[model samples]
Target: MSNATPPGWYPDASAPGTDRWWDGTAWTAHTRPAAQAPQAFGPPEPFTAASGDATTAARSGTRIAALAVAGLMVVGAAVTGAVLLGRDDDPARPEAGPSGSAPPSTTATATPSPDGSPAGNDPEVLVDQLNGITLPIPDGWEKPDRTVEPVPTMRTVDPYECPGSSSDFCYHATVTSRTASATDITSAEQLARQDITAAADRAYEKNIVGNRIHGGITSHDQLDSAPVSVAGRAGYQVRWRVNTAKGPGGYVQSLVFPSTVGSESLIIVRYAFDAGPDGPPLSLMDTLTKGIRPIGDSATSGGVGSSIAP
Candidate 1:
């Protein structure tokens, strides 16, 4: 016998209570009532190799493949009709948790809770389970796409193709949430200042493939930099008005604060909006930031304060 399940009958995954014949590698059309099937589904009769190396290798391969499927993250602009923040990459660290839960290294691709299930659409807020924080979603913002991995995000309007980069999509405004890198201890002010440039670039400079979507950022000016409280934690935010070579450039802001739950690692929220008259109102930034709250089964919205002290 080989490592493959010996030719036998196994339960049909598609049809309940029926067993389908397994011709070793795949299921044959033959089916019969489960009561008539002889062997239970699983490893077949003992193979010739006593060492069992082939079976062990096959099982290991299967496990790796499954893990790979579970770890993918979605970048908003990368997909069609996704009205959330879009970036080729984010400088992030895996989310810290009690069970040591984390996502793929620097990408900060939010790993679902150990339950690993979609949290579903909340009409008013987007929950970041990994960060233990919730962001208020304005009325017109597109809710997180439950079909994609649950990364905390929301944006204004439906998505559209980049002016020239048809392969990628664009959003007039988008907000995103994720854990910040933990390698060094840095104040929220420093982190936010350092991040605005990258935030601006990711939003309007170019498409994922280096195609100039908004032509390219021609210049940028600091609009605001201030100390603020976030989710009851001392935090800071920086905003910029970027000029683009083609379309109406946009404003980008980086806000950093501490997570109220678990390890208390830093959390970063990014916002990007087009600058034309149709773009989102600049006041929306302060509104969303003020709505940040901790998430829990019985959590209530206290309304994040804007003071420098907690």
Candidate 2:
């Protein structure tokens, strides 16, 4: 050991799944179990169903509210991988759902024109070039400045400190869009089902940085999962009302479809909204889903889809 090896813990070469402490120079025999999730969130096993209808009162119970905006899936986490509808065994390392994650795509951010669109040259639209679709910036929402964060999303409120933990921040409502996989071969239904779990985990359970923003997720109910369409293309969706241990837990959804551009890469859109009276009405999910349309195409309301009841 060097004279100045900084006093701290380091992975033990002699042991696996354990950390050895280094007082400064020599390694100490004292060891502890290695952190289950020290960095990137691993894809967790599918979670079992929780007993309860998705309701406002559901937030009152002491269930852990997880999964993000990375954020309770900031929507970004959902695009990645993680567990679904399962109970998180370890509260310290929240299980992946939105699944810790990805930075939003790079886009040109400009002042909202009178029409109020938040990306590129279109004053009324945010174009997701990777997915070859457009997401309408509904009333009371604004496209965030692309430079502030890489996510290609719209937010109902500005970023604010998390109510549960000061180290983390949150968005009362957020919708993120991205492409899931260009190389994988899978049906949209399967992809959406898998991704939403991660989204809920990554966003609310704990952000990519591993901060449990909503007091950490305890359980979730699969509110809805159904076939649908986006931008006139075949798609599917899964919605869950994730219960947290603190604050007003929230609802998160993942919608998957094939992109129109390139080789038809799969596209996923994630949504997160706080639970209780302070949060946006759940119908907004249906309203936003109906608002998606193809870029340069005027038609909205891609097709019939499931709705979350109040």
Candidate 3:
């Protein structure tokens, strides 16, 4: 061999068997190839069964328990429905349910006659009777003038002056008579004013005209500026415009007291027509004023009290 060492040979640098051989450029001879551990094997011990069967049993039990609960709920609902139906069908109960307990049967009561007087058999006859009193019903108007006989002691007549005309449609002239006390007699003038004001309030549905009370008489007029008079009473003559099912017009009401008895009398004349171009007819007002008379003669005639009648 020549003096140069071989290119691939190298001395081992480890003790004995542990010595590593080198292949010149690196120590490749010292490295061992990696090996994987072998897996243990046998007749797979008893092939342990999956817990799937026990899990299925538990799941099936849960489903059955849920179904049982649902069934019990359905049964409870049916029981409640049956109980309700049974109660509804029970014969002991009246057709009305328990909440609608039957009221005690009561005998029908007859309506008592008004003012302890019998009702009129004939409305026309009643109207005629009413017309015979104080106020005269205008002719050519409806016959058997409307009568509201609420009480035997009270009668109200609605006499229209002219039913066809809207402008002058006057309601029935009314005459009311009733026994009253001395107090009623004492306050006749006040009552008259009150009645007039009430009527005007109803007619206009507005403020009462300014007025003055003089000589036991309270007089009301329009704005205290207009010139009007009633029954020579030296005041504005007030007219009330009234609208009704029959039509619309004006009403002139007067209150008078009986000369003999301490009682009250009322007269209402309804003038139906458009307010005349010259205003209400002086003739109508004159007639109405002149017509008011107390039941008895005047005090000058040796009567106990003075009559308001003309």
TM-score of each: 0.58, 0.57, 0.29
Please report, in order, the local distance difference test score of every candidate based on alpha carbons: 0.60, 0.59, 0.27
Tell me, by TM-score, which candidate is best.
1
For model 1, how does the per-residue alpha-carbon lDDT over 1-310 read when each residue is reduced to its tens digit? 2123333444544566654443334333344555442232242222222434423322332211011122334764332332332332211211111111122210123223321223333456576655667777676676545423234667776787765566777888888887676347567788888888878887888654566777778889999999988878999999999998877888899999987754466778999988888688888888788788876534555332233121
Total residue pair clashes for candidate 3 = 17
Expressed as tens digits, the lDDT of each residue in 216-295 for candidate 3 is 11233332122233322232233444433323333444343322211113223222222334223435544544443222
The C-alpha local distance difference test score for the whole of candidate 3 amounts to: 0.27
Off by over 4 Å in 2: 1-123, 147-149, 299-310
Ranking by TM-score: 1, 2, 3
Weakest 10 consecutive residues of candidate 3 by summed lDDT: 98-107
Clashes of 1: 0
- Candidate 3 stretches with Cα past 4 Å from truth are 1-133, 141-185, 202-252, 259-282, 293-310
